[model samples]
Target: MKKLFFLSVLLFGIFSFSQTLSSTLNKTTLALGEPAVLKINIENLQGKDVKSAPKNELLPFHLEETKDEIIKKQNNYTREIEFAVFEEGKFQIPALDFKIGENTYKTIPYEIEVINTAKKGDKISDIMNNKEVKLGLKDYWQLYKFYVLGAIALIALFIIIYYFIRYSKREKNTPKVISNKTLKDLELLKKKKYIENGNYRLFYVELLEITRNFISTQYRIPANVLLTDDLIDFMKQNNTISQENEKVVEDIFLRGDLVKFAKTFPDKETMGADFNDIKDFVKRSSKDIEFENIRSDV
Candidate 1:
């Protein structure tokens, strides 16, 4: 009786540990393109320490397999299969074979529905048309804006440089003042009637300006800013003027200063002689200057 009872218990335990598999779905019905996760649970593998199992390569109809996550325990394994269904219909997922060790397990079939949300029941809606993006100035500017701006900037820079060169050449060809031009200036000053009006101070002032302008241009000196004595000293130091010219300059400068500052008035005869003396000096100095505008004083 003890042996028979032990045999019955062993058979019952073997029956209790039989292979089992079940399939479930996270969603029953879903919109087209939506995901449906199907889970498969397996238990009680026949071989405890088996080496490997056959690969089950079959997938459900009309369902795209997105992912398959498997969880393995001591005696069971669970698989979560994520799928995206595009076709609109009811689908019965057929039973799949799961070969674990030596024994094969089967999962119960599942049913899921997929619907098209773009249309109502039995009424087809107009599908969206393809759109063509029209390109405008702003869009084209975004593509080539750097090259356009750089070209404009370069052109402006070249224009500025060109004008600057032209201006420089013009200035280089022209002189501000020249000794030969003093004759024309002196003639204009004489036309002012400064001496005839008994304005000896004004006359001397105008005459001295013409003299200074001539000296500054001819000798490349800032004679307009120099005192009369300083000017004479600089000329003497540099031996730029002859003795006769120096004497004439000293006499005219000293007398001109007296007339301007001390209110000393000169007669018409002395003024005329002083004016002729200045003309003589200019004529004598410009003889060898190779000036373009100088005319012989008859």
Candidate 2:
């Protein structure tokens, strides 16, 4: 097992009959999270095997080992490493240590520049200087949308739930909306595949509407026009749902409102989970499934 060492800080390697190792970087400058390539090649391996590329993880940037290539005829070894820097600054991808069999090897350090700013220049500009840009509705909305939308959503939700509760108490004698119809609504929503298509806003809109409509018909509530808070209040007053189930239903509606008005994004899993939650709620909370079955039989 022979050892190799490089005292030279120069970027290039010295070639020899025994073994020559060299490293090079494909890029030195990149935007934050941009990736750079480091290539290492070894020649005259004399039949000993370096199974894989070695990487230094203690460095400032994230590093990953890419595919390695070995040529038996030429007795050469080559590997390309891909690394990305999230931090903005000049960085040195420190020399990586490699232990192949009993021989140890090191790759020379490489320089890199990671820029955080969106501009083409390297430096981050100073804090925003006040400039009189004409403010438009869009500008104002962008500045305060989270707060304003949140307030509106909260208010709308309250109105909806209040009406739902008021009417729900009056509909105790009303026939339960059939389970099949509610199930069809769920099926229709699934067929729309809004989440799959990345139309989250419309997806939530339809889902909330469906859930609310189901509640409106099932419990004699005007849920079609209500929000999460209204439904919560209605449930609490009516004792229509157990605390655990009420929590699930409330969370579903709240999440729907967030996606609809708060510009919240729900992932596929979240969307699917919420949909299933609504479906389960409708199945369990609907009051007259047995009567519906008997009526259908008749």
Most accurate candidate by lDDT: 1
Candidate 1's residue-wise lDDT over 88-150, tens digit each?
Answer: 999888877777667666777778888887854577556986789999999999999999999
Regions of model 2 farther than 4 Å from truth: 1-177, 286-298
Instruction: Give each model a TM-score.
Output: 0.39, 0.37
Which residue pairs of candidate 1 clash?
Answer: none
Compared with the true structure, all predictions reach lDDT values of 0.77, 0.71
TM-score for model 1?
A: 0.39
